[model samples]
Target chain A: MRISQLSAASGVPIPTIKYYLREGLLQPGEQTAATRAEYGEAHLRRLRLIRALLEVGRVPVTAIRQIIAAVEDETMPVHEMLGTAHYALATPVEAAADDDRHREALALVDALIGELGWQVTPEAPTRAELAQVLVRLDRLGRPASVEKLRPYAEHVARFAREREMDSVSGPREAAVESLVVGTVLYGKVLDVLRRIAHESESARRHTSGHPAAPAG
Target chain B: MRISQLSAASGVPIPTIKYYLREGLLQPGEQTAATRAEYGEAHLRRLRLIRALLEVGRVPVTAIRQIIAAVEDETMPVHEMLGTAHYALATPVEAAADDDRHREALALVDALIGELGWQVTPEAPTRAELAQVLVRLDRLGRPASVEKLRPYAEHVARFAREREMDSVSGPREAAVESLVVGTVLYGKVLDVLRRIAHESESARRHTSGHPAAPAG
Candidate 1:
């Protein structure tokens, strides 16, 4: 098959496929001409795997590249593929807001450092990232409820510690990779939990007699 | 205090403060000079709140702006603010990769669409996002015990469905907002549950025997 066919089949655009190749993420295919290349079942399978990592796993390109290399080696195992994807998705989204929000974001970062006792850097999901949540909290007129968020925070913290302990048993190389991957995946884990809590709360509210109508 | 003092005290830089004002994400301090302005505790607190939303909540600037407007209006309710933030972080990440690996992402998205019957958009989560998880999965060399993940997924679906049933009695506007927010927070809810599951897995593994070391 041709690159266009691959793109059509994979639901990825041609330009993006070119980018992946330029970035050294995807391997070079059999050259049909100076400008063209031929792909096949492996390419199709790999495309599907790549899509899974991006959609369900939320893996970044750099991480995806590494995994792709491993997958192509044939020496790599299936479990490794799944584990790598899991960790990649777990990474917290980096704060990349425009300059306008930087000050408010920095202040939030400082507050987390000074007040919340978190040892995060400005680059890690900085204040700009959390500002959205604070604004939402403010809008809801429940800025005070951050106190309520504590228990849930603690619940996550405990589990995070547990995951840390579990991660330490690996070989040094694997452990480091796992830690990096774990850090990434932790963000997604938070995402998943937050959703569940909302759903559970809504469920409880309904069972209490105030069956809320679905929003338009 | 002068902008510098505010910066010093708030740990936010002076230029960033100016940027916030320029963007209208933050209100201007007392207008002392045509160019120089004095800020106060309110500014500091508001800045902090903005930072919190950006860093901890991982909300977008546009959303933060809307949220701020709601909070300042005094018309917005507390629960609404809380709910919105929860949802913002809960929505799925966008897809942004173009490789064979993305096929996996497309498959899962298709599965969710076909088998699970969700109304999510194809652009909902990009392949780049899902690839993160795939990389980790690849590294871990474990099957994600999809069997392990299945129960949690089911639990979340049930939780969500139950909530949809319950909120039917609320005022139309509130119910509508709740559903929207519910969809957004869906990701967070899963995060929380997965963390819980990880802990449960950890506890089980720890109690079972020698810790399960990572594969070499």
Candidate 2:
């Protein structure tokens, strides 16, 4: 297939494909002639994964490059590859240095992990991210304790372990591509679903002759 | 209390508070003299909310302004205010005006809402957002049916209905501020929890001598 066909099939535009090729996000197609190149099925699959990450996941271009590198390295074990993809997609939380609040939040996060019996990598960015949100919630006086986070943790763990792991099965490249794409898309799916749920609940409460608020 | 006191109390810097005041994301403190303004407890609360939206939610500044305006419009009913805030925070999905894929997605979303007996607002941005995600997932060959999304929808809806609604209590401004802040931050908290859960699951599978993948 030519570049044009790859573009048509993948729903990606020609110029954008060119941009990706220039940036080495998409591996170069076989040079069939002076200015024409032939893209294969692998190219198409890779292109779709890149677009998914860029558009759906909103992973930065640089991060996408890192994820691609990690995925293509077949020598990497599945667990480490998932971690690389995870790290690439999740921006690190900016935990302040030498801050008492940050230390307290870190301790809480570690404690939560211990209590939940979740063997998160010592430096999984989500740990810091969770800690940061905990600190922020505490500041707001909402104060989400470990117990408060347990429900969310259990919900996602069941989904990831039961559904997500089962979802990633196929030949090596295909499995990896889908895993990388699913990693971000599934999260977005959850986010939109949550929003819709809130909208439904909001509508239900208001329509049931429930006044929205005491002062409203 | 002066702006300095507000900053100290909120842990926000003086210049950032000034910027928020200039942008009207924060209402101006009372003018006391040529170079002085007095901020009350309300200012501190609002400042905390604004930072949470900015840092935790990563909401664009313009969107945050719109959310602030909607939340401040005390006359608006709770449901409508929530709808307004939802619209403000959720960047609209770009559903192509005449794309068949989008049309099909829209129909699917409507059907899903109907099946769930959810009375979502007609123009709820999340409807389009959810539809778009379904389309994207389909293109990835991971077509998530309405059934596939049900579990996530129920999970989030339960959280919103049972916990989130009840969490919003207090005087009017306090209630509204917390609601707006919680709306975004809680989502972040859930997101990190999901990631942590995945990390834990990955560890469990790998440490128990599960091969990460076939060729890895």
Candidate number achieving the greatest DockQ relative to the actual structure: 2
Residue B34's lDDT within candidate 2 is 92
Model 2 stretches astray by more than 4 angstroms: A1-47, A50-76, A95-98, A138-142, A209-216, B1-76, B94-98, B138-142, B210-216
Per-residue lDDT of A113 in model 2: 78
List, residue by residue over B1-216, the lDDT tens digit for candidate 1: 998999888777889888888989888888878887888877876776666566555678897787667656655554454444444544464453544545564454344333433333343333234444544454434334333344434544554454333542353334434444434432343343343334334343434443443322
Q: Give the docking tier of candidate 2.
A: acceptable
- Candidate 1's residue-wise lDDT over A99-122, tens digit each? 444455345434433343332334
Q: Least lDDT summed over 10 consecutive residues: which range in candidate 1 chain A?
A: A117-126
- lDDT (C-alpha, whole model) for all candidates: 0.51, 0.75
* Per-model RMSD to reference: 12.1, 6.1
Candidate 2 structure quality by residue, lDDT tens digits, A41-155: 9888888778767766677998878777877888877777777666666766774753787778888888777777777778788777778877777776677777777766777
